[model samples]
Target: MLATPSDFDVLIVGAGISGIGMAAHLEMMCPRRSYAIVERRDQIGGTWDLFRYPGIRSDSDMHTLGFVFEPWRHEKSIADGPSILEYLNRIADERGIRPHIRFGYKVVSADFRPDEARWHVTVELADGERKLLTANFIYLGAGYYDYDDPYDAGFDFSEFEGDVIHPQFWPKDYDYTGKKVVVVGSGATAVTIVPSMADKAAHVTMLQRTPTWMFSRPAKDAIANFLRKVLPEKVAYAITRFKNITMQDFSFKAARNKPEKVKQALHKRIEKALGKDYDKEAFTPPYNPWEQRLCLVPDNDLFEAMKSGRASVVTGNIAKFEKDGVRLTSGELLPADIIVTATGLKLAIAGKIKISVAGEPVDFSQRYYYKGCMFSNLPNLAVVFGYLNASWTLRADINSEFVCRVLNHMEATGTNLATPVLTAEAEAKIEDDDLFDFSSGYIQRGKHIMPKSAKDYPWRLNQEYVFDRKVLRQGDVDDGLLSFTRAGANAMMAEEQLEAAE
Candidate 1:
């Protein structure tokens, strides 16, 4: 059965942080430009609402993580999962975006029509019923991970007596009180959960194949909190946000420039935190800083737990999972009643949705990215890929603003369509590189699935927020690369509709 197709000027997929942020921007910037957001899950918060694992928190500071328009109010910049979800919900409700959201709709496919200058989006609902939606423009905020298809590290723990858990789909009712918990993997999740679960569990063991760079920071931003009390909310937020961003930018550049010096300094910090008894070898990572995400420990919580003898770090390859715990390749057995796999997310490009142009399936890996927000040769479509170094919202904020500008530009001109088409010569000249330069287990596992990046501007992943802001926010939209055209009657539809609405 052909479902009722609701036509919108713009269609946003996923009601997560990025989608919601974009939706809010559309309302504020292009108020007359009608749009609807489709969320796969029933809930509004994407990762924040989904992950119910203990001690789930943002790796970056909330001052920068929070939306540019609305500053983070709380002192605790490194907020927990629930708090972040609450913040997103508040933004949705206050912006009157909740009514425009169609929950339980998973985008299955998007087919663009060059003739009509429109997209026909197909989404599957919870009841297996599929609906066809039409939109002039599509902004996919469907994050860079597959929530449904979590990355399985393929640990041979099939015969383990105790229950095994993945942080991606943490059970709501499960309790780990008084249980000996063994957390697998040494990414952000493992580092976070170890300290959190240690409080309730008998003891928590962080089992890692390799070490990650762990840096301790204050849980609360005292300066930001103090400024909020003294100055105007917006003023305080702006100052604090810049301060954090500058520090982060400097630190990342310094690390990249002097890898050994940065690595030694990081090791020294970890050594100081864990004392001389702790194996410094276990704290040293093989890869250089920024090659993988730097693990953030708020107030040295993870280290403090390890120092108190409540939590421990075990660096070894798992031989197999025994009835009680996991056995290492070195013949060491760590006893545990529960095992938590903190293996990183399965990196997804545009939420696994099948896209086609004129009935031909589009190969995203072949397509070049245009200024981080869009893809070359993809018409009227954009995907929000955030910063690999700084806060995700930093890039998201710029993306939303750029999208608004693009829509505005389309309306100003008689053209209703725009697509970034890379020239054959340009494509041939640009050297291809990994989409994300990180060497983490999950990224390495899914590197084949990720896009091949180009070397220069409008194609490469800069990894810096500053470069994105300049290119995406201030760069010319009608640059020679992007081709804009018009359909028959709808050529002036954008301008007309906006005028009519106004």
Candidate 2:
């Protein structure tokens, strides 16, 4: 039997950007709705607080990464982890969202009761106590990657006499000064760490099996800064956000439609940054631009570090780990005093929380994603999985607003349950598509666990931010796909009829 009297109207998992955004939206749109945010960590910022490595910053510009309701007033568009954390904290305090967040509480599992039209959520408290809380709806914003485990590249670190560190778990006050540091992998983490560590390390070498496309832009946005000086803060922010979103969308579409042209443009920028005589193989990727996310180098910092003889890039397969350093397949020995495995992340679905409906476990791989937020046949639950090609908060903002619309619709219609029901006949007619079309290692590894997708909107997680913004914001909530029903409506009606006969 389920607990009586629901604890909250909505239970938001993870106090990350997505979770906070949802809460903020509820305050503005659904003022009377009671909601709570549960976060495993003891802090407010999710990724910003977790990652403490040097030069840890946002790959995307802050205008887009920031919440739509808040303005990013920092001079630098590419913000550091601390500054981003500060922004989130400010939003929480100003909006009174911090009071609603219960830190150090991890959601263990959630089971939806069809009869009650609510979810019985099980959470593990900080002191290892399991608590039960029931809510009318569940919103998961726990992020995509596993917080406890990172993607293991399966490297033999026995022979290495130096300290081995993964960026996910950076040691506090780690002294790499005057030490030869080697950072493995070629993604954003490696690019950011190499240049930042080069300032103190004797030398920093980035080792990668394959090269990744790199793009450089100034940390500060000149136009955005200029607009801020002349216009009001909110107006300026709105204009800047719109501009960045348009440019991002255009670039992604261009890369997809005209690969060769985009590739040439990217190569030209790299050639200009590193000089024409630089090693093309070290900077060139086999795939076209945006095939994987392009590493953003602020103010050509990585290139400057290379030019200063403090940092370098080496592309080769690792043969083994030597006593002093790593051995390459090409019979090259890169001596190092410290090794930083700047590897990728281990992706997880729904924060790895066990979900069930009517006593049956939910297999997300078999269920279809309904409009990128809710799942098919899953009632009163929504998960925020951000965009791959653009800023994460862009999707988060839309999804939060969409959820608000859903809640308001339910109240107006006097319905207790909202489920996106996909009939067997309709499911048979739809074709399956890759949930995430990207070739990133994490995406490929986590594909089997992800929800199924189709070729069209309302069935798949749409990549186009502009398109999603319009559809999610202006779209109808009572679309025939979503079936709404009141809990115990028939029994109540029958009782009323019997009373009338007497």
Candidate 3:
């Protein structure tokens, strides 16, 4: 039996950093309006709380990753997972957003009904009971990466007599101490896990299918720390945030404008850190800088691990899983007591919730992203997704502010529906490399599921703070693609337009 529908002015999914940010903005914009933030987990911190692998941490600097309105009070720029999680929890508690979050409620599907001009949401409870809800607007703050098991279940793990573990679905009771372990994958997660686990494990081997460019920076920002000691936490946080943002803008510009120089500098850094004896071809990516995410090494822990003879790196394809270990394509048999598959995550956009309009499924693959927020033909729904190059929160903060502006505009104008009106022709011809060129598993799933543009101003992902501020923060809201309609008028909009034309 379906329970009575819970109504709200705004309903947000995923209670993560993005969702909470949106909720805070909504509260500030319309205090009298009803809003709810739904989360599947018992706790609030989305990725930070879910991932419990050995020495888990953020790959990006914390100065840029933390919320803009609320500064992160931590001394370190690159933070471990627990510290990051604690900071998020503290923000929720301090901001009074915790009370608004409905824990253990997973939204299964959401359908937009034109008749009511509202979204009908179906959510499943922790107790295996289903509930129905309706709202004027739906905000998808659910992140891109899947939080479930990290490994591909189809992999023939049974053939390996050794214990296998995926970082996403870590076992609490299992101990890696004094055991020879092989960690697979070459991205940030694998790079981090090997160095941290090497000290505890007897021997840690990092098996990379393709080498990624790794760079080292100190975990603690000396300037930021000095400022924290002299000034307030909030003030220091702001200073660090500005510094990080400016640095990112400069780096992105340099990479784009002076590609050769950026590549040369990157090559020099890798050579200096990895030593001249290291295979340069295996370590350097074939694409330009920021084509894929770069690996972050805090204070060169990965190199230190290698120097101490506790860790080693190998580049090869896995042929098959043997009873005792992995067999590489080079015909080398690496003995491993434990295998860690840090393979990438599954991409789940809008938390993979099914959406339908007038009983017809809304094919996300066919739709286009409007300014990387709302989708074409989908009214009153916005998603939060950041750039692959720059800090995620910086982009998300802009998105949050934009959402508030949109909501305020709707209220003041008496508009109930706003949707991007991209034509089939525009969507079909628009081509950008970021949309389809990615080889990552997550990108593969969402290939062509977003808007792609080279120019950063109107619809492109410039990843520059300056460009984003001018276009997203201060740009005109009444762009040509967005259409607004009042309540009870959506149904008659097409008919009225035809009559007026006649």
State each candidate's clash count.
1, 0, 0
Candidate achieving the largest lDDT: 2
Off by over 4 Å in 1: 1-6, 489-502
Tens digit of per-residue lDDT, candidate 3, span 115-210:
576898999999999999898789888887766644363568878888888888888867889999999888888999999999889999999887
User: How far does residue 32 in candidate 2 sit from its true spot (Å)?
Assistant: 0.3
TM-score of each: 0.95, 0.97, 0.92
Model 1 lDDT tens row, 20-126: 99999998999989999999899998888888899989999999999999889876999998889989999999999999999999999999876677899999999
Residue-level lDDT tens digits of model 2 in 1-502: 3446799999999888999999999999999999999999999888888999999999999999999999999999999999999999999999999999999889999998877989989999889999999999999999999999999999999999999999999999999999999999999999999999999999999999889988899999999999999999999999999999999999999999998898888878878888998898898888888889989999999999999999999999999989899999999999999999988999999999999987789999988888889998788999999989999999999999999999999999888788787777778888988778778788899899999999977888888888889989998998987777777875354233323322
- For residue 429, give model 1's deviation from the true position in Å: 2.1
RMSD of each: 4.8, 4.2, 3.4
Task: Report the Cα lDDT for candidate 1.
Answer: 0.86
